[model samples]
Structures are given as structure tokens and as C-alpha cells.
Target chain A: MDVVVDNLGVFGRGLLVSIQISAATFVLAGLLGVLLTVCRISPVLPLRLAATGYVELVRSLPLLVLLTLFVFGLPEIGLIGPLLWTAVAAMSLYWATFFSETLRAGVRGVPLGQIEAARAIGCTFGQVLTQVVLPQAVRTSIQPLASLLIAVILNSSLAAAVGVTQELTGQTQLLDQRYAQPLVTFGAAAACYVALAFVIGRSAGILDRRLAVQR
Target chain B: MTVTTEAPVQRRPLTVRLGSIGQQDAALFDVPGPQAQRRIAIATALSSLALLALVALAVRQFAINGQLEWDKWQLFTQWPVLRYLAIGLLATLQVTVVSGALALPLGALLALARLSRSPLLNRPAALYIEVLRAIPLLLLIYAFLLGLPTTGLRIPLFWQLIIPIVLTNSAVLAEIFRSAVKALPQGQTEAALAVGMGYWQTMRLVVLPQAIRMAAPALVSQVIRLLKDSTLGYVVSYLELLYSAKVLGEFNHTIIQSYVVVAVVFVIANLTLAAVAGQVERRFVGRAHRT
Candidate 1:
């Protein structure tokens, strides 16, 4: 018990790193996802095709492969950085593809008649989008977006595979080595993950209820 | 500051483009105007150039690093290398198959318990699903790796990966099955009961089959996930594809090449699975429409 207490600091640091990576991944992937969705739905045929290609290509490969490529392949081009950042970049790219698909589904879910009505009411294309389409799309998208975030958080555990030691999984692994108490150390890590997942899940549920559309 | 200067409303050309795109038929959108065609042509040309430049840069970097050695790839043509990769592929498939076979019934059982009337079964099933879903597959894998041997069971290392995967995947599969079951029209279950079938009989014959059919596409995709996930076997030195890639990379001093090869193999395999799932889903949808 004392040993476990003593190891809290290490676990805490790893947890912090995991949070930092996940937060950055969430923000970056969100922006990229929106961009990709826009590209997907844009008038530019090439852009749409490119976005589709990118998503499919990324989707077909495993995240571990992407991480390995970034870890081993980045330095070749003089793009050296912290292991965590590299992993984050790879992960964000991997997730942005899925996020784009999710957002695209949301965008498609919006009723076409609403957009036509907004346009008939003298709304510019931009106004129709910002005022009418995007709001509803975003509202419809919250559940999926939350699930995507949960996936990012869960997948961030793979960062440890690439030697990013400042995450919950990494820290737990380190402690497991030192204390030789796999059940206790990993069990503690599992508790932390479950707690984080619950927080995310509960918040998503609250937002879903609060933002429920009155159809 | 006395007179109000009109700052231009920054035109969101992109959003406008998206709106226009959405309004038009995706294929026929190109047939309308020369202006649209030219715009598309210019965009394509520019994007192509950007892609080419990115590829060129990567090529140059690899060239400088002397990682473009033809000999490094030749090893792939040899029997030993093929055998090694085959072994890794076999390990991955074996784990995915065994775990998947186990997960289906376990998941169905979990789903049944969750949907059961009794709180005793319901609460624990729900609890198990939520807790297991919250846990990362990696952590579960690690726990099994470290904890299982302590039981003094001389279980093979392969079981370590398989057991954890089955446990985690069953929770996920349970949810999929639950959703499928819930999505069924209430009439089916009630009709089965009306025919005087027992509850379990109704579930086994009427509910479960239809639900499993509805969930087949999702189940196949989940199997693809299991395939990719079996790569985590690298952590415990289970000699899956990724681990084999690492071994080959270390042996040949061609880390990036080995990873690229492994990635290609995974991509092809997963893409094939996805294609199969797509076909199955279409067939199911088509059958429903016909019926």
C-alpha cells in the first residue's frame, strides 16, 4: 500500500501527459475534421475526391502503422520532435478521418428542404449554412462527436507503444515493472481510465438531454 | 471614428461552395457550366502539384538516408521472410477467429442478461459492459500478460492476447447485439409470445436470428477491428504482424521499409474485409427491399 502511494506521483504525471495529448488531439482533429467535411461537401470536385481518398486511405491502415511511420519516418525529413507530439500528430490525423466521416454524416442528416427554405427567405449560401444547416448539423452530431473523443482518449494509450512515457498506460507500465504488482498497478490504471470514460460519457449524456431537439 | 466604416463581411467562399455542392446533383453538377469545370480543373491541377511535391520531398529524404535499397526489399521475395510473415499472419488470424467465435455467444449472453427482466441478471450485465467498455484493450491485454501467470496456470502466451481480446470485444459486441435487438419491431417478440412460445424460446428462435442478421455487417467490421487490434500482441511479444515487422526491421536495418510493407499488408487485408462487409450489407438491404 505504501509502495502504491509512493507511485502515485508517477501515475499522475502519466495521466497528465495522456490528458494533454488527448486534449490536443481533440482540438486539432476537430478542426481538421471540419475542414475535411467541408471539403467533402464543397463544390470543388477535386477537393471532395481528395478528402474521400484521404479518409479511405487513412481508415484502411491501423493506427499503430501510422504511429510507426511518424516515429520512424518523420526524422528522415528532419521533422524531429518530442515522442508525445509525434504520436499526437499521427493520432490526430488518424482520428480526423473518422471525425470527418461522422461530421459528413451529420451534415447529410440535415433536411434539404430546410436549406431550400433558408435560401428562399433571402439567406445567402453562407447565412443558410451558418444560421440553418450548421447549427442543426452540430446538434445532431454531438453524440457521435463525444464517441469520437472517447475513442481518441482510448486510442491515446497507443502513444505508450511509441515510447511516450508520460501517459497513464506508460506510467502504469513503469510502476508495474518497479513494484512487480501487475494487478494493483494495472488495476489502478484501469480505474483511472474508467473514471475518465465515465466523466466523458456522463457529460455527453447531459449535453444530449439538454440539447435534445424538439421534433 | 465619427462615421461608421463598413468592414467587409468576410466572405466564406468555402461554406458557399459547400452549399452549392449540396444543392446540385453530385455527378450532374459538373455538366452545368464552363466556369465550374475550369474551377475544378484548376483545383485538380494545384492539388496534384501539392501532392507531387510532398511525395518528392519524401523520396528525397529516403534517398538521402539510403533507405531506398532494392536489396532490402528482395528479402521479401525469399522463402524465409515469407514464412516469417505467414506465421505472423497466422497468429493474428488465429487470435481474431478464436476470440470472435468466443465473443459472439458471450456477447449474446451478456445482451440477454442486460435485457432480462430480473434485476439480478440485468444489473450485473449492464455493469460488466460499461466497466469493460471503459477499460482500454491495451490495459486489459497488459493485465492478462502480467496477472495470468501468477495463477500458476501454464497457459500459452497466445491465450493472454486472446482472452483479453475476447473479454473486451464481447462487451462491445453485446452493445451491438443489444441495439440490433432493440431496433426490431416490438411486434415480432410479442407475436412470438402470442404463439405461446416460452420467453427463452422466443429469444432463441425469433429474436436472436433476426437481430444477428441485422447486426451481421457491424459484426464483420468488428472482426476487422479485432484483426487490427491483434497487432497489440507486439507488446507481449506475441509475434503478430507488427512484431514481425519490428523483428524484420531490426534484422535488416530497414525499419521504415518493414513497417511500410506491414502497413500495406494490413491495408489490403482490412480493405478486403470492408469490401466483403459492404457486399453483405447491400445484399441484406436488397433482400429487405424485395421482401
Candidate 2:
């Protein structure tokens, strides 16, 4: 317990890095997700096929393998970047597929009648999409997106494997190695993660309730 | 309470939405007019060219890195190398199977306890499920890996990996089971009780069978997750596919090729599992509609 107290600054900074990675991934992946979702539902055959294939392929592979590939494989192709950015890039690429799926599901949840009603009211394709589809999709996706954010935070720990040791899990491992207090260090780290997850989940719940469309 | 006589609405299988673009696409867009068709055709051509260029760029990089060399991949063609990877795959499957077998039953019990009328059973079950679900599986694995050794418990490498996976997945599986149970019509249980059956008996005979069928696809999806989690066996140096690939990569000096091959193997295995899950879901949906 004293070990954790003595290293409070270390844990706090590590937690901050984890949050930064998760935030970066959420924004980047969310944007890419919207693009993929658009392509997936678009009329262009090749774009649809390409987007679908990417999502399916990425979804099947493990995040750790993907991380190792980016960390080791990308340099051979002359695309080296900072380790932190590499981890973020890999995570965004991976989670974008999931984000697209959730967004697609959210679009699916939009009633067919609403789209028809919008079209009947002389709304163009762009207007119908931007006005009718996106708003409701955003509302329906809040909970799943919250869950994905939590997943991103949890998965950011994988960065440690690829030598990004500034995050909570990696720093905990460092402390454990230095002090041999795995229970104290790891227990504190777990508490931080659980607390973050709880906060995200509860906030999302409140947001969902506030934005829920009354039938 | 009124005993409703309506046929249960056919809920679309989650796999259909997940695995493919469903009929919802038609609702999302209008059928193309001639002008729209021509625009789509041009867009398709442009996208195809873009995709082809991306592929060419990737191939060029591989060629430049000498990663496309026959010498690099030739190691995989040999019998010994194949056997070594096969052994690693066997170990991966062993961990998945053992952990999955333990997790499914334990998860079912947790779900049952959570759904029980007594707070004594349900409260602790809820806590276990929520806490486990929130924490990353890697952390749990680390706990076992680092924490156990400190207490003078020198367990085998296999158990170290398997124990944490079981702990984490059982919680997720419990949630899956609980949702499937809750989705059932309350009438089914009431009917069973009315027919002179006790609560546990109704659950055992009437509720669980259908819940399992309903949950089959989701359960298979969880199996895919379990398979992916087995790759974490690498962290413990457990001779799983990823770890073996790393070892073989180092020995053969073909790190990139080795990881790529193992990744392909994982993708193929997972895709096959996903297809099976879709099939199970279709069968269940068909059965449900017929009844």
C-alpha cells in the first residue's frame, strides 16, 4: 500500500497517458468510423466492398498482433513514427472497424418510415442523411460508443507490450519490477481502470436518457 | 396478469446484422435513377483504381524490403516448420478449450445466481460480473502472472494463462446468459410454474434450454474472443501460436513473415468460427419462427 502512495505521481502520470491515448483514439477512430460507415452504405460497389473487407479482416485479428505488426513491420516499409503515435495509429485503425459497426447498427435502428417521411417531405439525399439519419444514429450510439471508449482505454494497456511504457499498465509493471510489490502496484492500477470505466458508463447512461427520443 | 396469446415477434438474429450488410441498406437509400446509376458507375471506377493503387503500393514495399522473397516464406513450406506451428496451434486450442469449458458452466451458474430471487445469491454474482467485466483481461492475466508467484505458488505456465482467461470470460458469459434469459417471455416460466413445477425445475426444464439456443450465436462469438485471448499466452511465454511464431521468427530470422503467417492463421480460424456462429443463429431463428 505504501508502495502505491510513494509512487502516486508515477501512477497519476501513467493514468493521464492512458487517458490521452484513449481520447486520441476515440476522436480519430470515430471520424474514420463515420467514413467507413458511409462507404459501407453507399451505392459505390468497390468502395462498399473495400470497406466491408477491411472491417471484417481487422475485426478478426487480435489487437496485440496488430500492435506488434505496426511496431515492427511498419519500419521495414519506411513508415517509422514515435512509439506513442504508432500505438495510437494501430489502435485507431483497429477500433475504427468496431466504431463503424456500431454506427451502422445505429443507422439500422433508425426506423424506415422516418427516412420515407423525410423523402416525401422533399428532402434530398444529403438533407435526409444529415438531418434525419445522423441525429438519431448519434443518439442511439451513445451507449455502445461509451462501451467502446472503455474498451479503448483497456486496450491502450497493450502499448506496454510494444514498448510504450508511459501508460498505467506499463508503469505498474515497472514499479512491480523495481519494488516486487505486484499486488500493491497492480491492484492500484486495476482500481484506476475500474473507476474510469464506471464513470464513463454512468455518464453515458445519463446522456442517453437525456437524448432519448420519446416514441 | 393476462396470459397473452400473441405469437412472439421474430427478433432478427444479431449475427445477421454483424456479419453482413442486411436488407436495411435498401431502406437507407433510394434505388438509383439513370443519372444516379451513371454517377455510381463513375464513383465505383474511381474507387477501384484507388484500391488497386493502395494494393500496389503495399506490394512494392514488400518487394523493396525483400519480404516477397521465396527464401523468406520458404521456411513455412518445410515439414518441420509446419509441425512446429501445428504444435503451437494445438496448444492454443488446448488453452481455449480448457478455459472455455470451465467458463461456460461457471458463467451459467453465475447467471443463474444473479437471476435468483434471493439477494444472497444475486448481489455477489452481480458484483463479480461487473468488476470482472470492467477490468481488462490482460490485467487479470498479469495479476495471476505476477501476483501468484509472490505468494509462493509456482503453478505451471498453462494454468497461469488459463486461470485469468476463465475468470474474465466467465463474467462476460454470465452477462450473455442473463440477457438471453431475460429476453424470454415471462409467460413461459409462469406456465411451467402453473403446471405444478417448482422454480428451479422450471428453470432447468423449460427456461434454460431455450435460453441456450437463443444464446448460441453470442456464445460462439464469445468463443472467438476466447481464441483471441489465447494469443495473450505470448505474454507468459506459453508456446501458443503467437509465441511460437515469435520463436520461429527469431530462429529463422524472418520476423515479419512469421507474424504475418500466424496472423493469417488466426484470421482464417476466426472467420470460420464466425460463419459457424451465423449458421447456428440462422437455425435458431428458423426454429423460433416455425414454433
Candidate 3:
């Protein structure tokens, strides 16, 4: 307990980095996810196949493997960047598959009759997607997307393994090494994660309630 | 108009319920008109070209860095190197199985506790699930790695990895179990109670069997996640596949190739597990339809 109290600044900074990484990954993954979702549902055969393949491949690989690869393997291809950005890039690329899957599920939840009605009304394909499918999909997907955000935050800790030590988990490891108080340090870090998850879950619940279209 | 009959309610197979992607696309859009078809063709060609260009650039980069050299990858052809990785893979499986065996039953108990009528059981169970689910597995592993030693307790590397995997996954599995039990029709419990069965007996004799069957597919999917989580063994200095790859990579001076090989192995292993999950789902669905 004293260890945590004394290392307040370290924990605070760690939490901040975790939040930043989560936020950036959420937004970037969301954008890429939407693009993949569109490509997935597009009429283009090759585009759909490519997007599907990407999702399948990404889903099968673990985040840690991907992180290590990006950290160590990217330099071989001359695509080096700051460690923080590299971690973000890997997370975004990985979570985008999950996001797209959620969106696809949301799109599926939209009643077929509604899409048919839009088409019968002579809406263009693009218009039908923009005006009809997307609005409902986004609403239905709020909870899953929220879960994904929490997932991104939790996974950000893997950044520590790849040498991004400013995140919560990494900071705890550093603190533990210095203080030799593993229980106190790691427990504090765990509490911080729970608090973050709780706050996000609550906000998402409110958003879901507000945005849900009543039948 | 002809007289109409009510349609029977259809139960989706567990595979569909598990939300496999790309299958729902056809419902999202209409069959293309002539203009739409032409546009789709053009888009396909353009996207194909872009994908091709991306692959080409990646290949060129590899070529420039000598990463494409056959020598960098040839070590994988040797029997000794392959045997080393296989042993690491075997160790990874050992942890996954040991942890999974511990988690599933513990998860079932947690689910029961969370669903109990007593707040003593229910509240604490809920808290455990929520807190465990929220914390990252890596942190839990770290807790075991760094924290336990301070209490004057020292465990082996395997337990260090296994304990965290069990702790984290049991919570998730508890949720899966609870949801499956909830999804059972209200009539199941009502019927059991009407027959004078006690709560525990009713849960054991009636609810659990059905719920386990219902949860089987999801449980299999969770195994995939458990397998992935076991890779965190690298952090504990456990001799798991990823850790072994790092060692081998250093010895061979083929870092990229070794990691990529391990990555491929993981992909194949997981995909095969997923296929098994799909099969389990199909069997359950088939049994349900028959009854």
C-alpha cells in the first residue's frame, strides 16, 4: 500500500498512457473497421474475399505475437517508428477485425424488410447504406463496440512486453522491481484497470439506453 | 388468399449463434442492377490492383533487407530445430490443458454462486467475476510472478503461468455458463420445482446438463482464447512456443523467420481448434433437432 502511495505519479502517468493508447486505437480501429465492414458487404467479389481473409488471419493470431512481430520484425522491412505508435498500429490493426465483425453482426440485426423497403423506394446502394443500414447498425453495435474498447485497453498492457513501459502494467513492473512489493504494486495496477473498465461500462450503458431504437 | 398457418420457431445452430463473419452480407444489400454490377466490377479491379501493389511493395522490402534469402529460413528444415519448436508447442498445450481443466469447473461453481438466491454467495461471486474479467491476464500473471515471492512463497514457472490463466479464464467461463443457464426456458426450472426437487438437485439434474450442452460451443471457443493467453508464458520465462522461438531465433540469427514460423503454427493450431468447435456446435444442433 505504501508502495502505491509513494508511486502515485508513476501510476497516474501509466493510467494516462493506457487511456491514450486505448482512445487512439479505438478511433483508428473504428475507422478501419467501418471500411472493412463496407468492403465485406460490397458487391465486389475480390474486395469481399480480401476483407474476409484479412479478418480471418488477424483473428487467428494472438495480440502478443503481433506485438512482438511489429516491435522486432518491422525494422527489417524499414518501417520503424516510435514504440508507442508501433504498439498503437498493431492494436488498431488487430482490433479492427473484431470491430468489423461486430458491425457486421449489427448490420445483420437490421431487419431484412427494412433494407428491402429502402431498395424498393429506389434508393441507390450508397444511399441505402448511408441512410438506412449504417444508422441502425451503429445503434445496435454500441454495446459490442464498448466491449471492444475495454478489450483495447486491457490489451494495451501488452505494449509493456514490447518495451512500452509507460503503460499501467509496465509501470507496475518497474515499481515492483524497485520496491520489491509485488502484491501492493500489482494490486494497485489491477484496481486502476477495474476502475477504468467500470467507468467505460457505465458510460456505454447510458449511451446504449439513450440511442436504442424502441420497437 | 389461402388460409395461413403459424410458422414454427426456428432455432439457429450454435455455429450461427457464435457469429461467424461474412455470412450475413447478402442480407445487407440487394442484388445489383446493371449499373451497380458495372461499378462493382470496376471497384473489384481497382481493389485487386491495390492489393497486388501492396504485396509487391512488401516483397520488395523483404528482398532489399535480405529477409527473402533462403538461408534465413533454412534452419526450419532441420530435424533438430523442428523438434525443439514441437517440444515448446507441447509445453504450451500442457499449460493450456492444466489451466483449462481447473477453470471450467471453478467457473461452473462461480456461475452457480452468482445465481444463488443468497446475497452472501451471489454478491461476492458477482464481484469476483467482474473484477477478474476487468483485469488483464498479463497483470494477473505478473502478480504471480512478482508478488508471490514477497510473501515468501515460491512456485514453479508452470504454476506462475497456469494460476493467472485459470483465474482470468474462469471468470469469463462463468459468464458463458450463466448466460447459457439463463437462456434455458423458464419452464425447465418450474417443472423441476413442481416435481418437488430441491434447488440444488434441480440445478444439478436438470439445468446443468442442458446448459453445458448449450455452452459447449462457446466453451470450445474459449479454449482458443486460453491457448492464446498461454503465450504470455514468454513473460514468465516459461519454455512455451514463443519463448522457444526467441531462443532458437537467437541461436540461428533468424529472428523474423522464427517468429513468423511460430505465428503460422499458432494460426494453424487455432484454426483447427475453431473447426473442432464448429463440429461440436453442429453435433449439438443436430441432436437438438432430433429431439
Candidate 4:
């Protein structure tokens, strides 16, 4: 308890980093997710094949393996450098694969006739996509998107293994080493995570209310 | 292309003007003209180039690293012997089956609970669900490592890891089911009640089966989620397939290849779920039609 009090500042700072990364990745992955979803549903066979392959490739790969490869393996062949960007790249790639599929499903969720009507009204592919398809997809996807955002928040903990600094889990390991308070330090770390989880849950509630009003 | 050949300056199908030249000149079936064919050829070439990059990356990684010798994919069967291989696979299958079994009825009950008029029950149900939804299964699994053993539960290690997951999954599926149930017209239930049935009997004979059918896709998706989240058992020493794959990755030093293999396996697994969902949907629709 005393150790937790002294290191509360560090833990709090760590919590903020976790939140910031999660928010950034949520935006990055969400936009990329939409693009990838479009690619997945493209009229071109190659795009379809590549999208299926991409989804399969990323989905099957163990996230930890992805993390380690980005952190350690990338610099070996001179593809990239440094840990933070590496972490972001890996996380973005990983989340994009899943998020894109989710968005595709949401896009598919929209009625086909609506898209045809928009096209009939002289809407280009881009216009039909942005105006008719995406708005409907976004509205339908708010709940699941919120769920994925929470996933991004939790997955940020995986960043700890590669030393993205003492986020909640990283701080727990460090505090544990310093004072051997595995139970207390980890518990406190867990509390910080729970609090972060609450913010996400609350924001989802806000989204629900806003969406309800809009509807 | 309602081909009404009145005199037009540039008599092209509107779709052809959308740059779908290939479709326009394929004689509606066979050999396209040269220009349209060239456009298609270019598109195909660009496609090959794109795919070539990924294939080259995988080949180059294996070549540059010279780590192909490290992967022992055969160990899954050859080394594990007959007993542990079944143990390994069954260890994975049993947890998924049991948690799914637990999740279905429990999720239904939570769905029912949330719909109750009592604020006392509904509020806590909502809170429990929201918290569980927000916290990733990893942290919950971590907490469960410390949390479950104290119960002195005589169950095996699989169930030890399963409880927290079941709890989390039940929250999610319950919400999906509840919303599905709510989506049905209020008239259905009222129509049943008008014929003089109590809530439970009507729910049993009229409401629930319909709700379950309506929510089938979301429910099956959650089941697939259970399969993925079940992979989290590694954190708590449950030694699911991902953990096994990780062991191979670290031992062999060919991390990408290992991940590639495991990912292929996941695709097969989820595709199997998708197939099952499709089959069940067809069966249910058939049944509904017969009724």
C-alpha cells in the first residue's frame, strides 16, 4: 500500500499513455478498417483474394508473435527501427485486419437496394460509399466499434512486453521487482485498468445516447 | 442495358461508361476485344505485382533468416504421442464446449433479467455487463489466476480458466440476445397472451424459440468469439493452441512462420464456425417454413 502511494504518480502517468495509445490506434484502425473492408468487398477478384488472404494472415497470427517480430525481427532485415513506432505499426496492422472485417460486415448489413438507389441518382462509387454506405455502416457499427475500441485499450497492455514504458502492466512488473509487491502492485495496476475500462464503458454509454437521439 | 437501338451519337451501355469495358465487349460471354482486354490485362498484372510483394516478403524472411529448420510442425502429432495429442486438442475443445454451454443459458437468463421491470435487478445486470464488456479477457484472465484457486474448486485447470471467460461472454451474448428479443414486434407476445397464455408458457412456446432463432447469427458469432477468447487461456497457464504455437515460435526463432501457421489454423477454425452457422440457419429456416 505504501509503495503504491509513493509510485502512484508513475502509475497514473502510465495509465495516461495507455489511454493515449489506445485512442490513437482506435482512430488509425477504424479508418484503415473501413478502407480494408472496401477492399475486401471490391469488385476485383484480386482485391477479394488479397483481402481474404490479408484477413486470414493477420487473424491467424498470434499477436505476441506479431509484437515480437515488429520489435526484434524488423530491424534484422532493415525494414524498420525503434520500439514505439514498431509497436504502433504492429498494433495498427493487427487491428486493421480485424476492424476491416468488422466494418465489412457492417457495410454488408446495409440494404443493397439503398446503395443501388444512390448509384441510380448519379452517385459515383466514392459518393455512394461516403454518403450512403458509410453513414449507414457507421450508425450500425457504433456498438461493435465501441467494443473494438475497448479491445484496443486492453491490447495496449501487450505493448508492455516490448518496453513501451511502464504502462499498467509494465508498471506492475517494475513495481513488483522494486518492492516485490506482486499482489498489491499488480492489484493496483489492475485497478487502474479497471478505471480505464470504465471510461470506455461510459463513453460507449454516451455514444448510445447520442445515436439514440440521432435515430 | 435494355438495348433500344435508337440513333445515338455514342451508343454505349451506361455501365460501359462506368469503365466496365471488359463486360461491354465480351460478346456478353466470350473473347473480349483488344482494348478492353488490355485494360483487364493491366489490372491483372497490377494484382500479380501486389501479391508478389507478400509472397516475396515471406520467402525473403525465410531465406534471409535461414530459420526454416527451426519449425517442428510435426511435433504436434509425432512427439505428443496419441494420448497427449488428444489431450491437447480435447483440452481446447472441451473448454469451448463447456463455456459455450454455460454461456447460452446464462446469457439467456441475463437477457431476461435485464428486461425485467425491477430496477434493482436491471441496473446491476447492466453494470456487470458493461464492466465485463470493457475489460479485456486478458486482464480478467490474469485476475482469475489469483482469483479462482481460492474457491478450492476441485475442477481441472480448464474450468479454472473457463469461469471468468464464461462470465465475460455471458455478458456479451446476453446483451445480443436481449436486443434480438426486443426487436420482435410487441404484437407477437400480445397475440400469444390474447390466446390466454402466461408469460413463461408463452415465452417457452412462442417467444424464446423465436428470439433465439432471430439472434442466431449474433449468438454464433459470440461462439466464434469464445473460440478466439479461449486462446487467452495461455495467460493463466492453460496451454491452449496459441500457447503451444508461441512455444514453437520462441524455440524455432522463425516467429513469422509460426504465426502464419497458427493463423491458418484459426482461419480454418472460424470458417468451420461459419459453416456450422450457415447449416444451422438453413435448418432453422426450413423448420420455420414447415411450421
Predicted structure with the largest TM-score when compared to the true one: 3
lDDT of 1 at B143: 76
Clashing pairs in 3: none
lDDT of 3 by residue, A1-215 (tens): 78888889999999999999999999999999989988887767667778999999989998998988888888877888999999999999999999999988888888889888998999977898899988998898888888999999998998998899999999999888999988778889999999999999999999999988888
Which pairs of residues clash in candidate 2, taking residues 3 or more apart in a chain or in different chains?
Answer: none
lDDT at B215, model 3: 90
> Which ranking of candidates, highest TM-score first?
3, 2, 1, 4
Worst 10 residues of 3 chain A by lDDT: A40-49
- Stretches of candidate 3 off by over 4 Å are B1-23
Tens-digit per-residue lDDT, A72-97, candidate 1: 76775467898878999999899999
What is the TM-score of candidate 2?
A: 0.93
> Any runs in candidate 1 off by more than 4 Å, and if so which?
A76-78, B1-38, B284-291
lDDT of every model, 2 decimals:
0.83, 0.90, 0.89, 0.70
Relative to the unseen true structure, what is the C-alpha lDDT of residue B243 in candidate 4, on a scale of 0 to 100?
61
What ranking emerges by DockQ with the best candidate at the front? 3, 2, 1, 4
Question: Comparing 1 and 4 by DockQ, which wins?
Answer: 1
DockQ of 2: 0.53
**Per-residue alpha-carbon lDDT of model 2 for B1-291, expressed as tens digits?**
999999999887975544355334766667789999999889989999999999999999989888889999999999999999999998988988899999999999999999999999999999999888888888777778888888999999999999999998999999999999999999999999999999999999999999998888888789778888999988888999999998998888788888999999889988987888788789888998788
lDDT of 3 by residue, B1-291 (tens): 997697878988875643344546676667678998899779879998999999999899989989989999888999999999999999988988899899999999999999999999999999999999999988988888888888889899899999889999999999999999999999999999999999999999999989998898888889778889988988998999998988887788788888899999999988988888798789887997788
For model 1, how does the per-residue alpha-carbon lDDT over B145-209 read when each residue is reduced to its tens digit? 76666766667888888888889889999999999999999999999999999989999999988
